[model samples]
Target: MQQTYQTLNALTNFYGAMTAAESARRGYIFLGSSQDLQRYYNAKADMRSQLQILQKQIHPDESQEKRLVSLNLLVNQRLSLLEQSIELYQKDKTALLIQNNITVSSVQIREKILKVIADIKAEEQTYLQDSLEQSKQSIYFRVFIEIFTTFLILIIILGLCMILENQWIKRERIRDLESSLAQEKKIGDLKIQLFSMISHEFRTPLSIILLSAQLLKESLENLVDRQQLKNIFRIQSSAKIMNHILTDILILTRAEAGQLDFKLQVINLENFCLNLVEDLQLFATTANMLRFQKIGSIFKANIDERLLYSILSNLLLNAIKYSNNETEIYLILKSEADMITFQVIDQGIGIPLAEQHKIYEPFYRCQNVENIAGTGLGLAVVKKCIELHQGEIIVESKVGTGTTFTIMIPQENT
Candidate 1:
């Protein structure tokens, strides 16, 4: 029994030490602070000491000891990569960080270490369970032999044993739930990291494409030919679309990871809505016009400007994309005493009645709109932003006529 507890304690401590080392390494890489580096070194030493204790505790189980050895090897490999990452960052070689294998290998090694640790813990749990069963059987058999005649006492002891068994089962269920939650958290972190890496990789090329397209547009302004200008515009538009998709994915991942933040401030909603419409009008055509309307005299409200911008901009852009160029779009801002409402009305190819509920799901597009070029992320992003603001949106639409989106958010965030 003592051995089982010692092994379980060692496994828990080893995992904690591994987490500390990882946190410290990433912290040092991000901040380049001496204190962070010192923490990493301290964690590294503690990890080694913990491993020694873990090896000693699990020595009776060959399988667990072997798992520990494998874990140690992976930890060492990750530690080396972590050190290399710090060295490269300090030398102004961050550009090489993505091209090299260090980042990928480090993540793989860490995951492998975690797997080994989980396996060891599982084995330890089994050992403890087996020990408990043996102890239970021995005590029960002896007690029953001594009190075989005392039927009431036997019945009472049996009831107590059943209660203890149920409690143990409940404890095991809780532990399993905790383990599942931990796995989910790990998956969420990986998603954020993977999306972040993808965004970083695409951002530079997209920026260059936009810049080049802009330069070409400017340099060809005097040319008689409109074909080259159109091509340049196409390039710019495509790059912008790609950038928006990347941004949406990053936002969704952050929101899923519970990292999205809301910052509320007092602002004039009327002015904000007007400015947003004006900015969006730059993308409008002579055939398409944007009209803005404001209701209520006092327009000041507390809200997160960025989240509101995302929600409104996404709706407006979606309106523009799905509508005829000659159609008019209306953006209405209605500020009340305790609530503010935004209505974006567009004469566009409206959403299907059957699939309207799925529009807010990530990567879900209406079957009718498959011909249209979209990643199907805009509405999802808008929905996420609205949810962050603790608001609600109503969509009123017809298949071929038009769509109206109304969003209402409380003036004071609760």
Candidate 2:
């Protein structure tokens, strides 16, 4: 019976030693896994730092402080639980060592060790599950945050693109509107010019005709034969002026409508100019000089003779009308290396300095020459005819001194 009691005591001592060793093994496992906990804490700290950075990146308008407080509390609770488990295992190890003695078997000790190992593994699995759940939560939150940030950025980019597109469309519409307005203004200006031309140009010629007819019937009929004949001739001359002015108007209208057909032919330029000078002599009775200086060479080129005649006639008429009585007008013809230049020089009430630039504009007559008999379309027609021939015309004038109109015409090679 003593032997039997000794065996039972030995069995008890072996079980106690096994329990203490198992407790020590569990303590070592807890200590070993403490590094894992520390690592988890470091990961959480890194996550918190990243979360803080992400929060900073977010606009202050969105909610932020609540999420930060909740995450800090959860991490603190996990650390508290880990420290408590470590303390419980340490106390159990001290209790097991204090309770045993005297001849224990290795097999019994191993059985107790196996039971502790199974319990430790169970605790480890629980800890792993909790960590996995936390990781999944962290990952899901991170993914959600990234997607939200990307969506906001895309929306901002789209807004800017839309704004830029709207600005571009607005500018294009403004440009189109401005273009339309400019076209309407040009049409309105043309209509005004036409009205002025009809009133002034048409009225002057009609007045002359009516006045002459009335004078012949009422005042000149009682005169003697020679006086009566002179009066008739005066009436005829007035009619002729009216007819000439009408003809110029018709020609210019046809040209503007693209209905004027030119009969292009080569002509003797010098002879043509001479004949024009002789024809203009009759109208130069108002102390206007029409002098044609001869060019040294009899140079000729292909041109529409009728068009050239009109150009020269209009230029000389303008000179005569603008010049003061008895002012000597000059007609100069110069031949350069590649061009022929005709110049009309007059010492009249010259164009004003400010208006010289605008003189070429259609229907815009010089303010100084308003008293003169003009339709204001003469220079415009001259310019158009010259442009048709692919030539250039320039005018230089000084107020109260003189004016010079130079026509530079291109010569086609034969």
TM-score of each: 0.54, 0.44
lDDT of 1 by residue, 1-414 (tens): 677678777777877777777777776777677877888888888888877877777747677767877888888888898888877778774656552577788888878888898898777766666665555555445434433433354356458657755765565566677776776677678677767876786676577666545544543554437755676666666676667777888888888789887898887687688778876764565424888888887687888988888888889878888887788999998878888899999888999999899999998888877577787888888998888888999999998999999999986543
Those runs of model 2 whose alpha carbons end farther than 4 Å from true positions after fitting are: 1-237, 286-288
lDDT of 2 by residue, 1-414 (tens): 222223223333434443343344343534545544445445444544543443343222222334334434543443344344445455673443322321123334344444533443333334334444445455445534543554465467458657755765565565677776665455445434553454465555455554434433333243346545554555554554544555565556656655566776767678678778887775574533788885657446677787777777778877777777878777887765467788888887788888877865667798888667777777777876787778898888887788898898887666
State the local distance difference test value for candidate 1: 0.76
lDDT (Cα, 0-100) at 97 in candidate 2? 33
The lDDT of model 2 is 0.58
Provide backbone clash counts, one per model: 0, 0
Residue pairs with backbone atoms closer than 3 Å in model 1 (clashes): none
